[model samples]
Target chain A: MSEVIVITSGKGGVGKTTTTANVGTGLAQLNKKVVLIDTDIGLRNLDVVMGLENRIVYNLVDVVEGNCRMKQALIKDKRYPNLSLLPSAQTRDKTAVSPEQMIKVIEELKEEYDYILLDCPAGIEQGFKNAIAGADRALVVTTPEVSAIRDADRIIGLLGANELKKVELIVNRLRMDMVKRGDMMNINDVTDILAIDLIGAVPDDEQIVISTNQGEPLVGSDCLAGKAFENICHRILGEDVPFLDLEIKTSIWDKIKEIFKKN
Target chain B: MSLMDLFKKKNSGDIAKDRLKLVLISDRANCSPDVMEMIKNDIIQVISKYMEIDAEGLDIQITQTESEGNNGNVPALYANIPIKDMKHTGPAR
Candidate 1:
């Protein structure tokens, strides 16, 4: 069965596009036909993130407005034959595509793909509404920060109000060292407030920046963040995958405690 | 300082969690403390007219509780109004 999932964070720069790209690529790597849709109409970046920016002949607006066929607008990735991207138009704003049009486009794509991932824009505006219009599930990505968690809480409430019951969470950019130092919110602290099923927890890694810059998703690599995204993909496919152990490095204080216990 | 406080200093994570707990409760309830106060006053006025109740001891709060069948947590409006006595009156007075 085909599943339409929207990857969204109510605040911007929280790795929504990155998560969509990696997870979509991860699913494709699993031999599933996947299509990633960039719904951040005016500020399109998924294409660039995927390193397919130059090949865009048509965009989402063109497909929805009947200017081009849906197949004509889908950009196939060179790395993964099963993975495709429906890039958003850079000139047009969010109002260019209505929620109904989004649903119509998704309904057609649903018949051809195994999974359709929508990269929703920030805020609960038109872009967000259109992104979730035809989605059967939602993956809310948030960082381990106060503002991000607050916005995520609001987004969860909005999704519930919109009748999207199958909602899960992805806590991204977690710094274990900071968490150990009590400077950052831990996974438990975040999930306690959000109260949603956690699909993945990606640690803050510098390799993500390099991979994203190169237009290559790090899912197939051995990087900690890449492994985390791959595990999330398996979990999304209904597999019982164990979460990555984001244990902080042992400190001198912990060593002292251990010595005392031994004594 | 207390021994517990010494062991567990108030960190940023603790502060964030506490703040989020309060904020989420209010956000889910869709009302501020002032609005809750107004609601409490209105409920007291309406209920006191019918029964002799302890107006000062009434407690009305929006709390999170488990729903039937253990579906999930839901925001519930709980009112604990103390009933002191009942007003005795003739019918159709």
Candidate 2:
């Protein structure tokens, strides 16, 4: 069965775009046909993250407004043959697309792709509603911070209220070093407060920044965040893969590097 | 305070959990305060059918409790209704 999922985080800058890029890429790596839709109209970033920014001839608004077909708006990724991205319109606002329009677009994409991942914009506004309209489930991405958790709790309630109750939590940017010092919230602290089934928890890693800077999804790479994204894909595929042990065994060199960075 | 006392002080993680527990209960039951009035009134009407009750003393609100899912916590509705007397009813009609 085809599943349409919206990756959302109520607060902005909590790795929503990065999660959408990596998860979609990971799914494609598993040989599933996946299409990522950037629902953050007026501010597009999925294209850059997927390294397909220059190929965006048409956008979500073009498809919705009947200016172009869905295929014309979808930009195929260079690396993944099964992966594509439907970039949102930069000139148009969120009001350009309605929930009904979004649902219609997703239904068409459903027949072509095994999974349709929507990169939802921040805040519970019109864009958020449009992104989630056609989604069968939700993957809420949040960091291990109080502010992010507060917004995530609100998003979960909003998701339930909107009848999209099949939701999973992805705790991102977890720093195990800080967690050991009792300075940062751990997996249990987040899940206990959120009261939702955790899908994956990505450890804080600098490689994520490098990959994003290069406009590359790190799922195929060898790193903590990359492996976490791969594990998330496995879980999404119903493979019952266990969560990665994100214990950061700090070596002498790592401790020295941290000291240098702090200095 | 001694150095041991500093270590014994509540860690930031526990403090965050404590604060979020209190915040989310109100946040989750965000429809309270306004909807609470309607709920309290409806409860009074229902309870008054079976017994004379102290509607003024009825206290109902949202609180947190231990959850079953991986030891996580969830918001629970805590209702405290004070009953004045039971209305005597004859056997089923």
Candidate 3:
């Protein structure tokens, strides 16, 4: 069965596009036909992130407006034959595509692909509404920060109000060292407040920056974030994959306690 | 700083969690703390018109609680208004 999932974060720059690209690629690597749609119309980046910016002959606006066939607009990734991208137009704004149009586009893709991942634009505006219109499930990506968590909570309420009940969370950019030091919010702290099923927790890794800059999905790399994304893909496919171990090493306090016990 | 002070200093994670707890409750209720206070006062005024109520012991809060069955957590408005005695047994004031 095909699943239309919208990857959204109420706030921008929280790795929505990166998550969409990596997860879609991960699914494709797992032999599933996947299409990643960039719904951030005016500020299109998914195409660039996927390194398909040069081959975009048609975009989402073109398909929705009936200016081009859906197949013609889909950019196939040479790396993963099963993976494709529907890039958004840079000239048009969010209002260019309505929710009904998005549903129509998604429905058509649903028949051809095993998974349809929509990279929703930031905020709960027209863009966000359009992204979630035809989605059967939502993957809310958030960082371990106060502002991001607050916005994510708002988005969760909005999704519930819209009747998108199959919502899960992805805690992105978690720094284990900072979490150990109590400087960053841990996974439990985030999930407790969000109160959604956690599908993945990706630690903050510098390798993600390198992979993203190279227009490669981190899932194929040996980086920690890449492994986490792959595990999330497996979990999405109904496999009972264990979460990545992000525990920090024993702290000085714990070491001192161990010494006292040995005395 | 003392070792105790270091432990006592609220970490950013705890601070974020506490702030999110408060904000999420208010956001779900679609009312601010001040608005909740106003609503509590209004409820008290209406109830106290006919009954001797323990206004001091009244409590009104927007809390998060899990729904019955497989449903997830939901925001709920809980009001605890204690009634001391009936001020008027008549039908109307």
Badly placed stretches (over 4 Å) of model 1 are: A248-263, B1-8, B32-93
In candidate 3, list every pair of residues with a backbone clash: none
| CAPRI-style grade of the A/B interface in model 2 | medium
Candidate 2 segments exceeding 4 Å error: A251-263, B31-93
Ranking by DockQ: 3, 2, 1
For model 1, what is the alpha-carbon lDDT of residue B25? 82
Model 3 lDDT tens row, A1-263: 89999999899999999999999999999999999999999999999889899999999999999999999999999999999999999999999999999999998998989999999999999999999999999999999988899899899999999999999999999989889888888999899888899999998889889888999888957878999999999998989988888763356786899899999
Query: Which of the two candidates, 1 or 2, achieves a greater lDDT against the reference?
Result: 1
Candidate 3 Cα errors over 4 Å, as ranges: A248-263, B1-3, B32-93
TM-score of decoy 1:
0.81
Clashes of each: 0, 0, 0
Better of 1 and 3 by DockQ: 3
lDDT of 2 by residue, A29-114 (tens): 99999999999999999999888898989999999999998888888897999999999999989999999999999999999999
Model 2, first chain, TM-score of: 0.95
TM-score for chain B considered on its own, for each of the candidates = 0.63, 0.64, 0.59
Cα displacement (angstroms), candidate 1, residue A12, comes to: 1.5
Error of 3 at A257 (Å): 25
